[model samples]
Target: MMLGSSNAAVDHPTSNVTAFIRRANSIMRQLSSATLHKFVVKFPLLRGDADHLDRWVSLSAASRARRIVLDLCPEVEKFGDKNQMYSFPLHLFTGGSCVGGNPCVKSLYLGFVSLNLLPLAAGGSTTTSGFTNLKQLTLHKVSIVGDLQSLLPECAVLEWLSLTYCSLHCHDLIIRQPLEQLRYLRVLQCRLQKLQLQAPNLTEFEFTNQQVPLVLGDCINMSMASVELLLLSDDFDYICTKLPVALPHVRDRLTVGTAIRTEALVLTKAGAVFANLRHLILNVTIHGCPQASTGVLRLAYLLDLAPVLEELELHMYCVSAPGFPRNPRDLDAMATSPPARLHERLRIVHMTGFHGSRGQLELAHRILWSTAALDRLIMIIGPRIKVDYYFRNLTFADTGRLVARRYIQDQFPGTVITVL
Candidate 1:
């Protein structure tokens, strides 16, 4: 059962919201009392009364909805304003049995809601149980009050948990209890000083935030992980050196992203290795293009660490990068340097947001020249040079393709190259 505006992108008037609530009330009253497998109510611009919102949740609970999604569309303007968001009535689920007790909900997705769990009692312990059958939980743009750790013990069966753009009252988010069945965890754009989790069965983890101390205790089964850190200090070395140690068990796929002002790439610790790593993606944003060549060439050091890596993807973002230079001296010097040794195993290389700068071309040239096992090189032209930043002689893609055709096309006839 899905209600409210299907298109959350469009804003709705107050009268329409009020009418929607009235219509939803009528439908619920008219329907035959039965179980609901799924109940979804999405309204991006809804500011309904608390009583009306509580009624919807109560109806869903009474119907025994297995999956409930209450997405109030938390728009950009509602950010950081917890009072403006609706407070979810979690006490309705703190019961004993199914008939008059808790709803057997397996998945709960809440957006733009304030979730205030029960606080800790004396001696720092509390035993309020809710979401007992919840296997997956996703909270987006939500406000969390009290300690989050106090509420997780009740959710003993939670397998997947994702928190995006959520505000937690506490600075330290420490989940000491072992989530025995948790398989996946994702935390994005959440402000926290420290994060510590004990999920023994967790296989995949994704975290997006500024670099902070993280303790993923007993996560030996983690096979894939993506960590994107906003480089406030513009230090790329920290991402290269410290992250490998932090997430040591990442076996198959690994993605590391960072924004850097300085173009100097330094991998201090060469001992770190992704022994089982196959696919690697590097999402890098450079401040400028002139110094990009230096940092770009240094990526060879990182490639040396991933011995078994087969596929590599590069997403470069440099909007202010200048057009192709008349004389690319940096390209000539970089071309002579020996390629990253892992190129033999690297069969496919995909690049997105490519501006066809000298640095980008040089990297492409070096890879094509050295890698005999290379199968395909695909470069997707970016809109960086298309923007009227300055007077340009050619379009963004044209410049990149021209540079590639002039330098690389004739030399690398064996490999399949696609420039779009």
Candidate 2:
């Protein structure tokens, strides 16, 4: 039987109102920690100057929790300022009763809470002593302040770590462990200055930090990387110069996804080269409706950096809706795309962003004339409302193929054309 309450609103929550909720712990504390395999608690509308979440974590630790999820913030924090977030208890690390501390807690998740690693006593560094067996840890919207070193050191065998919208206002967040078994690491929408990731066995690393310089020490074994917010514009040359010095081996598969207003010209000047990069995908989003007379010309220039790139995909997007999204009835369908050669090793090319503007039409044809040995040319077309409503009323796909076949006939006419 499920034994937690989802009290929508605690009118007064006075001593008498919360007596039953507080007393429910007596039944829980009576059971050994080994008996509880999983525990979940969701408190709703904890009102005015009252928070009992700390006691819940203590009880979970003492009860030998294996998987624990505590969500203290389910609604907008408009009540008393003191009741916004719960402070996690730190005494669970120090073992007094049992020599084996929180040994069963392998999966731990805390949402809208505070994990202050600083010692509560007069003077002591917070220690992750009992968290030796922690394997999977996720902290979302968690304010991790003070000494954070204690919570990460004892996690020697941690495999996966994800921090989303977490505020770590410390000097620099470091991850260093000899032969650290960490394989996957992702950090998104974080406010940090410097990040140092030194995991030897790391395979997949995805980071989206706001212009934060990443100093990688032991990421020599990375295979797949999804990076954003690093090479934002041509003005910032830090990522270009620092990437090789930090991680000598660039991942074979690279995906550069960005929504900011950027031109392909700016990305080429970054002074970075992918000597071993195999496949590259560019997902760029423009700020406003692109002019019909001109194409962005941002993606074609990147081909020069990856000499051996075999497969390339371009997923273009526009911020605003285009006024006229169809080709004219009398418009000429056949025209020279352009100078004829951009990539020698390129075999396949796929484009998804199309509004049938003259600029995009010209760019599409240019790719056909340039690649001498290209195998496939795919252009995906859709209406502008695809952005506003998102997949509810998008039915302009057939137009994508019509534009590709009639106009921009490649110099190598054998290249297969696919429109979706």
Candidate 3:
């Protein structure tokens, strides 16, 4: 009931201070038995000898508060045995030393202890009798070497759990508890070789690490129907492969990136796993390939596959023979236009890295000529083209102007040609 240390400190702890303490205690006696929920204490520095720290401990013990956050001065290294039995419903021990033991009375809501000065207590573990009501748990920068299996089991009602930068070297990280109650779970930069999550109700599962390979074996089956957002990395192909086959129920909204194709034929046979996809973004980096024509063919194939695809983005680095023949075989094939029914649905077409090379020009001309329902055709010249060569040389603008003057202006009088 007695709040520690007043704003003004007298020259000495006189009889007048004792009288003030007695008066404060009298006021506390008149108050009701309603429990206090939150308490925050800031200490500039413990002034006196070790005994003075004892007085602060006594004052803390008097308060029956549930939640406590202690911001102590950096110089105060040791909070003696007076600190040992100091427990609360939620305790946050920050900027101190030798504050190793657990300090939770009922259930630690969000306990974070930063023990900078001392090596962790040997065989020490944060034990919770049963945080049946606990909702969220976060442990950061702690060195808990042994098994964490005993820690979180009590937190059966935990909704969100995060362990960041903790060197947990466990053989198997198995969530034996039914995490159907969990909504969000994240383990960032932890040295976890394997993790098995069986949360049927988990909505957001995000794993961000370059080295760690997320193996979602059969847990994809337990994910709830309401689960929407799933962000995974490149090494998640094991899961991505099974995703379309196993979880065909939620294949529509799943967005994946940079995954390697273990078997190109198997993935292709998956038949547009992302069939209901709207926005498709690809950053395909093909190495040692003879030509970028492979990527182009794959893109054309994907165009047919993704029926609902609206926005298609591609970053293709074609590292093949610099110059291509003006009239490629594909252009000749496109010149023999397919049925008009095929072109009716076409609305917009954007092609970047247009060098106006023979093959590229042919491809552009074919695209412009073939799409009967095409409304907008955006052709962007690649930045690799030297500006000096483009403006100084007359041949640069000649073909484009000739095309505008001859084919477009004469043949398709209504179409617009925008040069950027």
Best by TM-score: 1
* Runs in model 3 lying further than 4 Å from the true structure: 1-127, 139-144, 210-255, 259-290, 293-420
Q: Write the per-residue lDDT of candidate 2 for residues 335-395, one digit (tens) a residue.
A: 6555645667667776766655455565666665666565554434333332222553234
Question: What tens-digit string does per-residue lDDT give for candidate 1 at 1-420?
Answer: 888675434255556667778887888786538678998988753344678788888878777888999988644464435677788988766554246676488899999888887877776566566577889999998889988888776678999999999999886678887788999999999887788888888899899888888788767777999988865456466666666666667777888787665366554664556666788887776665464566665555556667777777777666455446667664444444444453557777776656667667766776565564655544333333322134433346566666666566545676777665
Residue 187, candidate 3: Cα error in Å is 3.3
- Please give the lDDT score for candidate 3: 0.40
Q: TM-score order of candidates, best first?
A: 1, 2, 3
Using lDDT as the measure, the top candidate is: 1
Better of 1 and 3 by lDDT: 1
Model 1 segments more than 4 A misplaced: 7-12, 30-33, 44-48, 74-81, 100-103, 122-125, 231-235, 289-292, 323-344, 352-356, 365-396, 405-420
TM-score for each of the candidates? 0.81, 0.75, 0.45
Cα-based lDDT at residue 170, candidate 2 = 78
The better candidate by TM-score, 1 or 2, is 1
| Cα RMSD, model 3 | 12.8
